[model samples]
Target: MAPSSPHRGVQHTLSSRGLAKLALRFFSSLRPTDCPLNCLGKARLDFNLLPLEGELHCLELFQWSLLYQGSKLVATQQSSQTGLQFLHCVMELQKKGIKFINREVESFKNIHLKDGTLEIPRLVILDTAMSLFLNLGAFEQCHFNCGNDTTTYLFFMDDLIDYAEQMRHLHNCGIMRHGLESDAEVADFFNQICKEMVLVSSRSYLSYLSKDVNTYFGNKWNGWIAILELKYFSNPWSIISLIAAFILHLLTLIQTLYGVFGYYRPSS
Candidate 1:
């Protein structure tokens, strides 16, 4: 009889060996920004799961976009009172009745719309973690509204767009290579992410992306905000200064740990 087939876990483990090497060798190299996308609008996004102090871990969103004709990094509207909002143009299309489409999305249409009459469907954005993975598979970039007030964002579109340009340049250079050392690095760094998903039953890895993206942005932003808020604190300068100093040191430590130390954020 032929050799027994590799168990799903074994296949995952084997596939993961390459990723593990990637992790040991280059995992921490993942940019603080977002994952890169390909010329075909294929990209992987991550939204780390951020748990709320209260109870529910709400799904957070990020954005994916493409650079049109020239090498342009598109900009979106921002507001301090609200938060980071992405895909305004696409969101507008919802008003015109365009529907977002994807598999594994619940009864709701894939596009962010409430009423699905389709004539520019109103943006019925669900706070679903699954959207991130699905969106990455579907679109080049996603639009995100992040930060407390929500104006802050983690835009993956530009990263992928930039990668696309680099790929084109490589293609022309006679040094064009099919596999990217960088993406391999990213995929490796994000191996834990993929591993976590494989452990689950969800065939669609998009939701995990949302979950990862959410956690990453939420924690980083909150940390920054706390740091910023402490800067102006003046009730008892000494006490505030002490606390602020600790926070500042922690921030730098985390950055350095992930940056210099590689592959570990030290689990804040």
Candidate 2:
């Protein structure tokens, strides 16, 4: 049997040649890093350097898409065997108030050399505040196309835990139920790609959320109930009226006592 890709941790054990192959596969599945909302390459690369989950993986030469210096990818959460639901899910994601892209990736056509040989992609070691980055290797002669073709060149070979672009796409789809040091660091950066849901909007989905999440929602049910119950009646006049009623009762009590005894009058 062949070794399989570990799906839950960072595997930095690939040989130089293996690493090169992994890099090619990573970029092959991507659009471009320069698009308005491509992956948070810097942070995701940091996280991928930490850990990931994949049962198996294999590298194929660029076969689809226009891989350029400026393009964005659709979220892969919807890229099941069914097809590219990125467009269908995009609006749904937005309806949930997330800030991520709300469109489906039609296709990604990879342009290979006429001789069918992929170039050795460029790899560089770069750094940011407290993290390191494995920059995207360039493909001077390579091209990619992202239209509506729903065929991902990913087949199970050895599961590489740190498949950069794939990991980034998963994160965008809110699949990172967990992460690691470098991955955690790019959290804010990752979150920025998509808008978070409004508190209420997110709550709306809590019904279908995991059991643990639903439990938390149940615990905080009082907060939402309060909002729904009093949201309409919350006004200045209501508050003022309540205060006035209390004062009136106190004044009435004082008058009743004074009239009952007329005060201990001295000779006036």
Candidate 3:
């Protein structure tokens, strides 16, 4: 007789494994009532009774699992004002001395603010991103249990990008990349995606982040520092000119003070 093929042996092993798994599932489904202990006599108990204690324990476990999962999705606290209103465009934030940094993570949920830098996960926009986001937004809206995470992200992005210049700033900062023809298209994509959609910023994951950004932007000192950095510290020549001007003013003040003192005391 010809030797059995190795292929047949492999198929037989897989088939046996499949049968074993099926038998395990089937046996696992049987309750203690369905397959009673052999020691317990039939007259001693009713097989029709449900296992109330085991069922209650299982239900409690399921509820706890859900609560644990929901807690993981929660971020910082809600803002007093609407979070969206506090979010300035990218250019505005840049002008206020807030730096934009690209986070290497793939998840949009990873956006955060630290110090004065806003770190956002890189978003790669393809031709299909619009449809994908729309479907995800629609699904989140229709399903009550599914949180509005995608909707919140879209709205947050929309608030950050009011025009092509803002989108270009985000791109220059490495926070966003797109295959769209122009920056204007990317700007329009975000602007249009969240149109007519109602989002409660207090419930958003980005609420606290937006509030922090606004606080930083509102500080007058940061604006002054930004202006100084832009006007004088941007290049070596500007910095030299500013230093020279400061030295000149200091020398003139010292000369005036020395002359007044010498005249008053008539020099010892």
Candidate 4:
């Protein structure tokens, strides 16, 4: 007869029910002040544990973990606004002199816009990303008190990426990296995940960021500057040609003025 398997005994000892009971007991032992959020908040307030500049604090780390766990902290405010519908695509924003900057962070909350520059954390998309986001979105929809942060993020990305070109722009800017076959696939992934999802703009953390971006995009001066840069200063050759033309025009104007002065008041 074959020897009894030790692995089988270990598996039997760690049954699903036993694990569930252990988790329940662990949670039950925690006091009201020991909740995850409360603990993180307390840690954040501790001066000794403060992180240096360019480092993430305790609460941010906790929020990042929650992001990967398919949940998020609840928003304190709620408004009747349906969702963010005024966001422009990547190319359009670029044409409006709105620059995209990669924050090089892993947290979803690391997105913000300041001084016409919109900073976003880098997003890595692998083969499993689709399933992961879909499952997270489903959980948010089904679980009570689970905010739709992930869904809102997906919607925001979908709005930014309208086609393959936009996806390529994001990849080139280091704001997104993907192992997909083509840029079109990445764009399609965001579009597909955001389909049929309801978004409350006021509840989304990116609402203010979006407003700031839109305000920058709406500025006529920015648009004019973008057009000038794209048309006349796009390359070294173009810039040199513009300078030469301006000099020629100035010389011609000066010559014409000198001749007019000579004609009006004859120089003896």
Judging by TM-score against the true structure, name the best candidate. 4
Q: Model 3, residue 268: displacement in angstroms? A: 5.3
Q: Highest lDDT, which number?
A: 4
Clashing pairs in 4: none
Model 4 lDDT per residue over 1-268, tens place: 9997999765654453354334434433221111233344333323222123333332233223434322233432342243455599999999999888787543465578877788877777878777666766776676534566777778889989989999998888888888789999999988887885666665676676677788888899999999999999999999999999999999999999999999999978
Candidate 3 structure quality by residue, lDDT tens digits, 1-268: 9999999876865565454434434433322112222323222212212213222223222212211222333342323234555587888888888998887642356677888899987777778778766766776676544456677878989989999999888889888888889999999999888894667665566676777888899999999998889889999999999999999999999999999999998956
Worst 10 residues of 1 by lDDT: 145-154
* Residue 138 lDDT (model 2): 17
Q: What is the TM-score of each candidate against the true structure?
A: 0.17, 0.22, 0.70, 0.71
Model-by-model lDDT, in order? 0.30, 0.30, 0.66, 0.67
Tens digits of lDDT, candidate 1, 183-230: 333223222223222111122212333333334334555445445545
Of models 1 and 4, which has the larger lDDT? 4
- Candidate 3 lDDT (Cα, 0 to 1): 0.66
Model 1 lDDT at residue 219: 52
Count the clashes in each prediction.
34, 32, 0, 0
**Could you arrange the candidates by TM-score from highest to lowest?**
4, 3, 2, 1
Error of 2 at 220 (Å): 13
Q: Mind giving the per-residue lDDT tens digits that candidate 2 earns over 119-138?
A: 11111111331121111111
